[model samples]
Target: MKILVFSMATIMKDVSMGGSQRHLRELLFHLADQGHQITVLTNRRQDNSEEYELCPGVQVLPILRFKETFPIPYDTHPFHLAHSYSLIRQYADTHDVFYIHDAQMDYGYLHANIPTVASIKNFVYPEAMISAFHTNRNYLIVSCDYMYSCIQYTVGRVQPQITDQLRIVKNGVDLSVYKPVEATRKSQLGLTDDDFVLLFPHRPEASKGIVQAFETVRELKEKLKGPLKGQLKGKARVRLLLPRHFDVHVSKETEQFYTQLTQEAKEFQVEESLVFYPWVPGHDMPQLYAIADVTLCIGQFIESFGYVQIESIACGTPVVVSNVGAQRSIVPSGYSVIKVDYGDTESTVEAIAELASTPMDITGVRQFLDQNYNYKENLLGYEELITSAGKGSSSVFSNTSLKSGSPMDVSYKLAPWCYVSGPKKGIYHDYFYTYLNQHELYSFLSTCTEESFSQMELVEAGVSSEAIEKAIEDGILVLYTP
Candidate 1:
């Protein structure tokens, strides 16, 4: 299938990246390798070269973005921007399906002329998603079980119509590229044989627990004062590997929070225990995950799916995360993974110390998780969805104008092939079946001949939108136009 993925900023990977960007980059790579003709559309400043690492063989098109105006704050969201709808509409007729990475983008506000699938990453602003339930060619994709439930709670409540269009597609990690400890982060950092590295790899935001992590470290280091059995060689002291940095798209609030964290770190006099790594190449993430004895994620916000925890576990790194959002499911208690409630400094420290005490072999950790989240398996699942979506785009509602030469044409009836036929079931499965008054419906179909349904006729029949959808799905009815 010819697929088009739309992302506002650069589709990023490797370096600490936002969840949506990472998801898109992974999807592009997986699908392109699967032989789909994929095109990535992005918004980046003018450059001499047009480069795309994620979609290696595909073309990356630069698009015009919404300009920030005075008085009104700059809308960084691409979907809400002026050109987003028009740009997407331009390509709607060409692509087989549209994969929009963000759910809150304004595109869903209008109907998609092409088969459109959107991944709802986080809690979308309600206003930005107006008319989503009624959107055409719209289908929703969720990565994890938690993500599905989160979207059901956040957006589903507002637009109940979305429930019918959702599909669960779990996130997959590339074992071939992200496999266990091929290289040591300790060796790269010049850490002595006796030092333990606790990696804090997260966005530079308060919600991400950047400061909370530092505070936890302050308390943890104090708690682990005694000798701790290191993952390697001998007794090892906890040395944190956290780079105080964020990419360009980071918010001003986040930058200020980072500054505050720096001040707090300086005040704590814990700089000696910190090891800062310079600009890390994107491909070195697996190595970084491998080097850490235990990856720390003490964020306070709700993570739809914690990718870092998955990547760390894949690299044979014991991951200890706060029991918040989807972290509990991602890093459930068992194996080498441990979860602590946010703000519980003592438990968080103890969890880390416990993992450090008895070294969990990198081989064992990798072996345990080898079958859990396979990238190829999930890629096939996505391909099935995309292909099905493209195939389903064949159906549309269309019609020709009806007229009365005598000026007495107030009557209408069902279109051709649609009739009071024998009972038809909704969807092949029984789950979507709506218990319609098939007798009344058949009577209505056989008798009604006055254009479309009048408000009175619909109300008298006690028909619902779902029943109508079920009727359409069951092939008891269909439109000449939609």
Candidate 2:
């Protein structure tokens, strides 16, 4: 099957640098191995220049030109959507399926009336946006059971008609690329022969919990002083490797935090214990994971799914993650992975100290990856789903079926009718209100007619003259007004 995948950015050379890019690279390679023709659409920037060349069978097409934006980085702009629509329309003429990674591309493909399968990554979308896309029989793929549940809840609340098409496919990692490396690479990164190095290899962002990791390490170093002095004199050495962009905003804050912690270390007389490395190349990540006594991912918010945690586990490196979001699902129940409650600094510190004293079972970690997150097994599932969707039977709802009013009534019926004000001229807010008010509630009373729902309706309430129009141009909203 010829498949077109639209992604914003990817890091093919460095598996550790970004999660979405890594997923795209791994998924494309695995699919290509299965003999499917694949093409990727991404942005053209300095980092992405070598992006398409990383994979052999996969073809990379740059859709837009833009400067790099970090933290929430990408090359997607409003103009890119217009360009993508034309590109996808041309590709859809020959390609079997259009697989989209983000919402913008989903909108573009839906507008072109192309068959699409979209992976839901975020929770929020405008009601008009939902209605416009919901009419099309598109397949929605989610990463985990948790994410799938969230998508179901949100869609059910806003646009339940489209819920039937939702499917869950957990993300996977390529263990071959992430497994344990030889000690020589560790020495090259400045680790001594016997030093215990703890690595925090993520973008130095506040949300990623870099400061919390540093605090945990600081506390662990403090607690180890007396035991080291008395039991193993001259045999204790601990360091931290924080690879980050020098210009990244959080890097300055991280450096400041490191300075303050080092000062505290001096006051506590343990200053010789911590070290910092600003940025490590992506290729060296596997070695960094191998040399680390423990890898930390202390995220405060819910991760859609964590790639770093999986990457660490794949390297046979033990991980300490916060008990929030997908981290719980990503790490197996009895593996060397340890989970601490979010904001529980004391517990986090204790977990690190415990891991330092006890060695993790590397074999169990590797075994977990082999069984669950292997690239081939995961990609096969995606390939099958894409192939299935391409055959034109993958839609959960059809307009004809929805119009028949069995499942349609259940999906579209709204409880407790409410009045809507405007899809007034020049005001998008009024347009949405009027659209929901006129079509969603009134049009469903009799047999559903697309004309009645599509046309604007003028209604009078106590004090307002509201003009109701559909939110999405071709989409209809059925508001239930009592």
Give the TM-score of each candidate: 0.71, 0.69
lDDT of 1 by residue, 140-221 (tens): 7777776565444334434444556767777777777676755555766877656767888765656667666677667766
Model 2 CA lDDT for position 123: 42
**Tens-digit per-residue lDDT, 147-199, candidate 2:** 65444444544555555777777777766677788756665566776666777
Q: Could you tell me how far off, in angstroms, the CA of residue 456 lies in candidate 1 after the best superposition?
A: 38
- Model 2 scores worst on lDDT over the 10 consecutive residues at 425-434
Report the C-alpha displacement of residue 455, candidate 2, in angstroms: 40
Q: Give candidate 1 regions above 4 Å deviation.
A: 12-16, 46-57, 66-80, 106-111, 124-137, 182-190, 226-236, 244-257, 278-282, 361-368, 393-482
**Could you give me the TM-score of model 1 versus the true structure?**
0.71
Residue 123 miss distance in model 1 (angstroms)? 2.8
lDDT of 2: 0.58
Error of 1 at 160 (Å): 3.5
Residue 474 CA error for candidate 1 (Å)? 39
Q: What's the CA RMSD of model 1 in angstroms?
A: 14.7
